[model samples]
Target chain A: MTNFVQLILNLLIFPGGLFAVALGLFLMGIDRKIAARLQRRVGPPVYQPFIDLVKLTRKEMVVPGTAHLQAFWLAPLLGFAGMMAAVTLIPIAGVYQGFKYSGDLLVLLYLLALPAIALMIGGSASSSPFGAVGFSREMVMMMSYELPLLVVLVTIALKVGLATGGIATFSLSEIVQFQLENGALLFDYTMLPALLAFLVFIPGNMGVVPFDIPEAETEIVEGPILEYSGTGLALFKLMTSLKMIVVLGLAIALFFPTPLGKNFLVNLLWFFLKCLVLMVIAITIVRTSTGRVRMDQAFKFYLRYPTVLALISLVLTLLQR
Target chain B: MKKLLQKIAKKSPWLYRINAGSCNGCDVELATTACIPRYDVERLGCKYCGSPKHADIVLITGPLTARVKEKVLRLYDEIPDPKVTVAIGVCPISGGVFRDSYAISGPIDNFIPVDVNVPGCPPRPQAIIDGIVEAIKIWETRL
Candidate 1:
């Protein structure tokens, strides 16, 4: 039992954690490449992410004088762990059998929220007024985005229920199985509004583009992350990258399900393609767009409008039935 | 023994950057230098050190404004011996655009003896990395 427990921990922490980190790094590199191509500049190599993390880890960690060091330090770790847990829940290359029971959509939602909460708490504890202000804006962004997220979830759930004739299942595998049987959500005419909701949610979820107010560098000086340096800063960035991957992965799984391949290599390739396509769309928009939105304007646009779109999607699903 | 030490230091000089009172243009470029893969400072054994005490090369950005003068001096003083200070960007090298401002002072070398002067409003990331590489060469030659 002890050895088995150790093995389980190793599996969860090593390959599981390692896979998320590597994928996160790759996705960030791809984001940079896409952003560069959009701007007509030669981009950095893909290994740029690995180089950055290595350099940061070796650097000294600087704790601000005014910060509550305890909270500040713990926040990034919490955010990182939460993101890793979410990644583990989602099937990467194989069948959803690995963490199947643990992979509930609701849990993924809560885990997805953890990174943002960590940012808020960490920023608020930094004791910088700017950091405080950033936290305030982040909270508003969170509040605004939360409604549309829920609506999308419910709409997807409703579609699953409809497909199964009221046999409700929130498991990710069941949803994929439903897709495999009846075809992808992208092919469903009724899913067009949900697709719109998904599109809007992508930017909001990654905190990229016109929606990236929390850590707006030009206006807020990396916002909540202003006081962080060294390893703490690196961890925060790593978590952000991981969160980006999780958001894109979830988006792919929901909107576009590529059937799992017979072997690991084929499945992995398909998985990566889906992820890359989503990441390219996300980062391209980020690079081409000019940012800096007032807190109120951002909330008003994302929450009110997208919620209506989600409602339309739900109604359409019912109408199709 | 000392010659061998100098050789090692020259080959792998770890850098630390301090932002006294930057407009942040230089800092972003500085970060970009470390980030963009072509000038990947990490492959050269050069990295951004966390603190001055552990740093071999100190790359100072922005003009030394009134508020940060003492802090800058203290940080410069804290670095261990055989350290080289490189004034990065135009602001730190000549006080750049803020030279005439009352709140601003002269170049960073005015506060601490700077070994190199890398001049650009926000020097390209590659240039900064190259400047550090040059500073390491100086350390190997003289010390």
Candidate 2:
């Protein structure tokens, strides 16, 4: 009973629900501020997203007459719930130990696809032509990015399993443990390509500039989400921010989760700093520096670059084993 | 609780542009308010959203031409309640150069409740920004 209670607490209070949401919003706010500063302009305050959320809750929700009401109402919750679960699976070194499961990584890989799937469902259910276009484009982007992500995960699983005298371990805690003892994989020459591939994958999965074709504001007017207003739009925004945390957390757990000292508070702060740095590099700078690419070009770019990069690491890890 | 929510919500009024049927001049100035750093509206916690559903401030450009009058009204109706309309340029306010043309049907307030008017042949980005600020004030009361 105590264990069950602890699980619930972990899911709702500490690392998963409220804390993750706050941290995610903070990271997003910082991303916007940095992007604005990069352009030599004063941006909205860091609390802007929080204000937006509050505002959305008070606004009236307008459902399209042609919308599939059930699906449209349910879509945002799917991604939000998935990310909430995904956050608990990621262990922060010396801070919060993640839920221990032998196959959590595999589970996470599936959970990570939920947001994209939700977007596609919502888009198609909206009955808008723009929504249909967004649905197709989102599917292509997901397919292209998933391949490289799969390859990268397999490579990491192999690297850890080989060193620990196992076939493969898809456990995140074990991965973090291995790195803590044997040094982070970030410094491993063979893991470099995989790290690069993951870096490339970040912007794509986050749907920032250069790959935000699905919700291209100028072209499709936010596509699937164009019709969603009030609380629905707020939920979608929260889901994206939560996703930012999940992806960045996963990368930290995978690569450089070396906690600072043994102090709990210090380690937590350290973990946040790492997330901020990663967000700036992988999302902010890249988004600020680039323009949207054509859907075909983005598909081809993901397939060619990150896919090959992750494949190189997979082959190297296999050869080393 | 409602009052506090209204206070917090007032800070994030998203703007949506509706091109009723002008010569694209006001639209160009509207773009500058977002694109040019010198006149950045984001600092006001204003974002230019693509859909009417997400908008809090309706920025109507161009004259209300007979061809697009119906579509414009439909678009305005699509914006959820508690929205303030800001007519940009003389066109939306009085049809400007297109006034009395056989195809023109503006002075937009005839159909939409325009709350603010930024009048210029093509209003300067600063004036448009000022109009947006005025609309946000009206929007706050409604919220």
Candidate 3:
């Protein structure tokens, strides 16, 4: 009975629903502000995303005549729900231990793919030519990024498991627990390549400027989301913000989840601080500095660099074991 | 709650552009407002959205030439309701230099309800921004 209640709270309150939404929106707002500053311009307030969300919800929603209306409506909700649930899977090292499952890491791996799949579904369902182009590009981008992510997760799992005198572990809580007892993977020389690989994966998964070919507004006109308006667009916006939290939270969990102290508030602030630093380094800087790459080029680039970087860590970890 | 929504909604007006057959001059000016570091329209809580469907504010440029009249009207219709149209430059308002041309079809307000008019051959960035500010005020009442 308590477990059921706890699950509901976890999904709706902390780490997932309300909290994740707020933090994600803030991160996105900060990202935009910093990006504008980099361009030598004054930007909008950090609370601009929240204002945008409120604004979007109050506007009119338009459904295209040719669209698959049911799927079009369901797509954003599907992604929103998936990311909300996925948030509960992240173990906040010194705070929440995450869902206590031996294979939660594997489940998380699958959960991480949901938002992109939801995007592909939404894009194809819109039935616009731009949406079709977006769907194909999104599929290709998802395939390219997933390779490096898989290798990074596996390498971390093996690194932790071997040190603990076992085979590779697929449990995220166990990985964090292992790190807590010893030290963070950040300082470990062997895990550096995997960390770098994960850093490379962040922008691709977040669909930032360089990896935003699928939703290139100038060319594809926001692709799959082109036909969405008002409340529908609001939901997609919410989905992306929540996804920002999930992806950045996952990075914090994986590489450098060292909490400042035993106080819950202190630890939570530390976690957010680390997330901000990571976002600035990996996503904000890269996005601000680069233009969108061609789909083929992005595909080849992801396959070559991050995939190889992660594999190097995996092979080295194996040799150490 | 409705009043509160109206207040914030006014702050998040997203802009989209429709080029009726102008020389790229007006379009370039519109792009400057959207992109140039010196004239950051984003500071006004305005973003240039790619799709008409996602737009809350529409910025129409150029004289509505006869060939592009139907298509521009169709595009304008795609913007969900309660949208404000700001005609940028003299072309969209009076057909400007194209007024007497055989192919010219506007003064765009004749087809679509234009709420604000910024009239210059190509309106200055400051004038365009002022026009947008006026459009947002008009938009707030509808929201």
Model 3: per-residue Cα lDDT over A184-229, one tens digit each:
9999999999999999999999898999999999999999899888
DockQ of 3: 0.87
* Model 2 interface DockQ: 0.88
- The TM-score of candidate 3 is 0.99
lDDT, candidate 1, A1-321, per-residue tens: 996785466346643477668878888877766666565556656666765665445445556677898998898999988987777666553534335562388898899899889999889888877689879988889888889988988888888987798745577767776787777899887788887787787787778768878877667766787666657777887898888767877787787776565787777778778888877766656546666577789888987788899999888887877
DockQ of each: 0.13, 0.88, 0.87
lDDT (0-100) at residue A192 of candidate 3?
96
In the predicted model 3, the residue pairs found to clash are: none
The segments of candidate 1 whose C-alpha lies over 4 angstroms from its true place after superposition are A1-15, A93-95, B1-85, B88-107, B119-143
lDDT tens readout by residue for model 2, A115-175:
9999998899888998999999999999999999999999999999999999888999999
**Which stretch of 10 consecutive residues in model 1 chain A shows the poorest summed lDDT?**
A93-102
Chain B TM-score of predicted candidate 2 relative to the true chain B: 0.95
